[model samples]
Target chain A: MTVNRQIHLVSRPQGEPSAANFKLVEAAVPALTEGQVLVRNHYLSLDPYMRGRMNEGKSYAAPQPLDAVMIGGTVGEVVDSKNDHFKVGDKVVGMGGWQEYQLVDANQRGVLQKVDTTHIPLSAYLGAVGMPGVTGWYGLVKIIDPKPGETVVVSAASGAVGGAVGQLAKARGARAVGLAGGPDKCRQVVEELGFDACIDYKQHPDVKSLSTALKEACPKGIDGYFENVGGIILDAVMLRANAFSRIAMCGMISGYNGEPIPMQYPQLILSNRMKIEGFIVSEHMEVWPEALKELGTLVATGKFKYRETVADGIASAPEAFLGLLKGKNFGKQLVKLI
Target chain B: MTVNRQIHLVSRPQGEPSAANFKLVEAAVPALTEGQVLVRNHYLSLDPYMRGRMNEGKSYAAPQPLDAVMIGGTVGEVVDSKNDHFKVGDKVVGMGGWQEYQLVDANQRGVLQKVDTTHIPLSAYLGAVGMPGVTGWYGLVKIIDPKPGETVVVSAASGAVGGAVGQLAKARGARAVGLAGGPDKCRQVVEELGFDACIDYKQHPDVKSLSTALKEACPKGIDGYFENVGGIILDAVMLRANAFSRIAMCGMISGYNGEPIPMQYPQLILSNRMKIEGFIVSEHMEVWPEALKELGTLVATGKFKYRETVADGIASAPEAFLGLLKGKNFGKQLVKLI
Candidate 1:
């Protein structure tokens, strides 16, 4: 039996998660039952939603159970299988979590899928053509519904989801604007990703100053917004939104630290006739096939650009997740676990 | 020629408007030209939107021009007409301002219209069967779109718009709940209007307490909300909202006083996946004909109920309007100006 190195949640986090809250453990791989496949995970996806799972409360999904393997998306090769549908040495993408190996039942729908990484890189399954990419597409096409020539804004502009949102907005013939944490990310967002303009939010500490910057960037006014980082960024956007605007509330990364951050100018939602909606991509599984097909085509054709911040091993996942919550990671954060 | 007594806006209000800001003047009626009709105003509508117009800044429409007759809706009798569409003794509704007489041109399509009040009460055209009623119907039908067995909440429940909203919500097979200022209004909202429950906001004094009451009233959670009075009441509704809730923001009477009131817990808009939208009734003229037909039928058949708080003369408009901002006037506040 092979040894499986795994990361587990030792305790629920009170505020920002600490190194003490996670543990790295090694265990023998259990024999797979009928209709099951054993996956040897090569890469584990780390995202901001993990912070909410670490807490003992209900958010979009249930809180992570203590002492359980930390939940995540993974791309790997199937080392062994007991089911007739699968064989050894097959590559797959599944919710194998933050572990060296995972036992996935073939009958369980949406838990496992075959992947062809000949034209596309394996890591792209967890970033550009995966969950984050689908999230951006869902918000942009279904909720934001940007019209031609309308200005669309995305927060956390250089990150995986925001990058996809900007590119998708531009693809629809809309003016795409971005808001990023620092100058470097802003430059990458505007120059590399083809966004019309990018506002470096770090230069403006308060919402008032940021609003001024936003006004100068979006002279015609924001018609659609993909909100990733909430707090002052959302407040600033509220001040500049045009009549009948739509906002897709994707994530509130700033308030994931258990702080009660209040939203200001909600009355603006009324004043501007804005429509804001929160959604979970997992619950909307019906659109994944269509989204992934489009995303895969875009990435393969070099029309879509993406970047990754890869940690060395499985043990680095806790630290990488901590860095992600603090906005330390420049792009999609991942653990190259083997 | 008959003399016209008019109340003109002497100055734009800095905050809540006062009697000093209006000047009453008696002037000779202008002679009718081609397509012009002479209207002797009978009832002048005193609405909350007038307060927004009294300010120098914009809301939905342009600010009421300073030193001009206060913009209002009126039901009147056409004393004389040069137009073929209207004749003497015909009862009509028009945008006649705060004046005892108005010269209306028939060519202005939306400005004037003849009404058949033989079965329906004439004054109902300005309240339950007019702009306020249409406002309620549009918000509920177009935005809220409540499903059967869902709970619907309305703020300012005893007023014209809120009353229509609750009645219409119940008509759609949903349980209607209300929030009003005092015990009397709350009683009327529940007892007279057939709401499932009514909470007196004056007793709660804060959002936390009111939210507790809302939880008890709406065991299924609020599926739809008709926002009329914004402030603590809006905050309370936000806390009790369920996933995928919808809010139709018709008015924010509390903010009309010019004090910058911040909305609390706007994150609920994201957490609950709620959709909130602000709208102007006049902008959506396509729905008017269908809405009027339904409202007229409901009122004529006694299936729909309404109450009126009538002030004696056109001069009482300012005081009645002041009372409205303070939540003193119940139902639709109108002036009997004949």
Candidate 2:
């Protein structure tokens, strides 16, 4: 019988999670029931939203139960299967938790076809060509519905979701502007992603000045805003929103750790007739296939690109998650298992 | 030659406007040019929006210039006509300002048909059937779109716009709740305007308690919010909004005086996925006829009712306006001049 090494929730986090909050333990692998497939994790995705799940609070999703295995999405290979749909050596993606081995229902897991590494890296499924890619696609196409001449701005521009948003918006013939933490990421976003402009928030400390810079980049004012980092950046972009502006709020990474900043100029919302909508990616799971298909095509054409900060083992997952919160991850953060 | 009695803007107010801000002067009325019609003022519509016009600050409309006639909409009778469409004794509505006599372009003014006073008073056009009525109607029907099972809440529910909003929302089959300053106005809102409930802010010092009361009245949570007085009331309502709630931001009368009380809850917006949209009734004037037709039918059927605080003569307009700021008016505040 195969033994599974799992990281379970040791304790709930107060503000930012630390390694102590997680405990690694070896447990006996359960027998595969009917319609279940055993998975050996190849790569586990570490996301910023996991920080929210670590805390015991009400959110779009329920908080991870105390003492339960740490919840996460994973790319794995089917080692054994009782289900007809999944066979041995089948590559799959599912909520496999922070575990070396997991038994998931075949219907609950997605069978990802083995992609040619020469064409596109297998890790793209965890980053640019995966959930993050689909998140950006759904927001840009479905929520924002940006027109050809309109200007679109996205925060966390070099990160997985924001990078995809910037490229997709550009693909739609809309002018794309990005806001990143540092100069290097900003340059990478503009030069590599083909965004019209990028604002480095670290160099431009004044929010109003950054807003003016963004306005200069987008002379007509922002028509669509794909918000990932929310805080002063959100406050800045809000000032430059034109009438009938659509703000697709995907995540509020900036304010997740701290107390929320009081909105300074909400009257702008009244004056500009702006529409801000917040949504979790899972809420649009049914329409995810459409987003994935489009994203897959873009990736296959080499028009879309993504970076990953992959940790060596499951023990490094917490550090990778912490790095994501600190804006240290260039794109998607992932934990690789041996 | 007709002499015109004009009220000029003397000084901009620091806070609540006093008599010192206005100066009344008499001037010989100019001869009507081509397309100009000589108007003798009859009824002047005093509204809260006029307060914004007095301040030398940014708003939807340009602020009144120093020493210029205080701008206002007036129901008047055409004394002399130099235009083809208008004739002597023709009742019309135009931007006549605060004056006894004025000359306006006939094309710039709308002809006001003299309706049966027995059916509804002529001044009802200034209140329930005019700008205020249209403001409430458009905000509720177009912006809020309250469903039958939805809960609708309006601030300043005893005032012109708010009273109309509560009544219209009730007619549209939504549970209506109002927030007013005093207990008397709160009682009047529930008893007269037929609101499901009314919260007296003065009596309920704790905003959270007031919110709880509003929540109890609206068990399903607020689906549509018709905001007139912004600030703490808005803060309370924002907390109670369910997912996909719509806020029709009409006026922020609470913050009209100067800087508002600093708001402490913007995270509620991201959490609830609420939408706050600001609109001016004038923006959707094309749909005015349809709104008026619906509102008129409601009034005719005795299903909708309106109350007006009529201040006799033009001199009382300032005091009435100040009273409106203090929530002294039971409904629409008007100045009747003969």
Candidate 3:
């Protein structure tokens, strides 16, 4: 019998999560039933969204259960199966949680989707061609709906979702501007990600200073914005937005740790006549096939270039997740449990 | 020749507009050339949007120019016409400003349009069948787009746009709820305007109390909110909003006069997955014909009822407008000039 190592949420954090909040454990893999599949998870995605799930307060999602396997997205190959669909050595993507192995009921349709890892890497399914990529596609195509020659701005430009948003906007013929925390991330956003311009937000402290930088970068004013980090960045976007702009509110990672992030200039929404919409990517399942097709083509053809930071094992997930919240991880933060 | 008595913006208001900000002056009506028409203004509309025009700050529209005739909507009779489309005794509505007589060059296509007041009264054209009515229609229909059986709420519920919004939502088979300033207005909203429920916002001091009242009134939670008053009312609506609720941000009248109205809980937008869009009514001319047809039919058939608080003469416009800002004037505030 295989011993499956896993991470569990030991406790909920008040402000910021630490190592004390997670516990690593080992459990023997249960024998697969007639319609069951055993997936040995290769890569586990550590996302900013996981932080919101850690808080006990009423949030976008239900709080991550204490003393349980930390809910997560995983891409791996099936090591054992007693099911008709999933066979041994078949690669698949599923919500395998923070564990070395997942016992999935293959009878469930959407629970497991077999992915072809010939041209695309197995880890890419957890980044560019997966949930994060689909999020970017939805915000750009459905919400922002940028036209050719329009200026599109995105926060957290080095991150998986933000990078995809900027690149996709560029593909639509819009001038894509990215806001990244450090000079290194800004370099990656501009040179690596193919954005028209990348603003190093670390140079500016407040809304006024950042707005000046944004104004220089987007002389015609911003037509669309895909927001990841809120607070000062959102305020700057509001100040510099063109009339009739659209803002896709994705995440407020800056204030996710029990901080009050009030929108300072909501009147600008009226003055600029903006459409600000917040959405969950999972709720919009209809667009996944199309978004994935586009994203898959982009990655397979080498049009979509992404960076990844991989931690060693399932035990490293907590530290890696904390780093993601602090903008420490350069790109898509993942735990390589293989 | 007729003497045109006009009110000019003598000075911009610091907090609120007082009599000192406006100057009542008389000028000789300009002589008409070919394709020119002289309109003897009957009713000068005193709307909340006009208050926004009184400020010198960079706002939705261009700042109401210093020492110029105050911009307004007017419904009146044509005394003389040199145009092919118009004749003497034609009832028309146009941007006539704060003046008794207007010399309009009829060649300007959209500056003037004739209205039939056979069943619908001339003053009704300024309220229920005019810009205010269309403002409600566009916000509710285009932005909110409330589904049947869903609960739709409107702030400033006794006012022109708010009243129309509630009635229109009801027309679409949705439960219409309202937030008015006082007991009298709340009573009018429920009894006269036919809202499902009405909450007297004056009874509640802050967001918590108002939100409690809103929760009780909308037990099913708010599916859509048409915001006219901002600050406390907007905060209350945000607290009581359901998942995937849509907020049509029409006006922030409460904070129009240089007060900061920051959004308190933008996190709720992400949690609730809300869509908040701000718009100016005039910018959407395509929906005017459809909106007017619906409103006109409702008013003509006696299915829709409206109240008017008319201040006598063009000189009364400034005080009437100031009263509107304070929520003192009920229903469609107008200045009757004959």
RMSD of 1: 1.3
Could you tell me the lDDT of residue A171 within candidate 2? 89
Evaluate residue A245 in candidate 3 and report its C-alpha lDDT on the 0 to 100 scale.
98
Two-way lDDT contest, 2 vs 3, winner: 3
Mind giving the per-residue lDDT tens digits that candidate 1 earns over A54-164? 888656578889998999999999888987777898888899989999988887776888888988899999999999999999999999999999999999989999999
Candidate with the larger lDDT of 1 and 3? 3
DockQ for candidate 1 = 0.62
Over 4 Å off in model 2, which ranges?
Answer: A108-121, A206-209, B108-118, B260-262
The candidate that achieves the highest lDDT relative to the unseen native structure: 3
What is model 2's DockQ versus the real complex?
Answer: 0.52
lDDT value, residue B73 of candidate 2: 74
Docking quality class, candidate 2: medium
lDDT of 2 at B188: 90
Give the i-RMS of model 2 in Å: 2.1
Error of 1 at B205 (Å): 1.1
CA lDDT of every candidate = 0.89, 0.81, 0.92
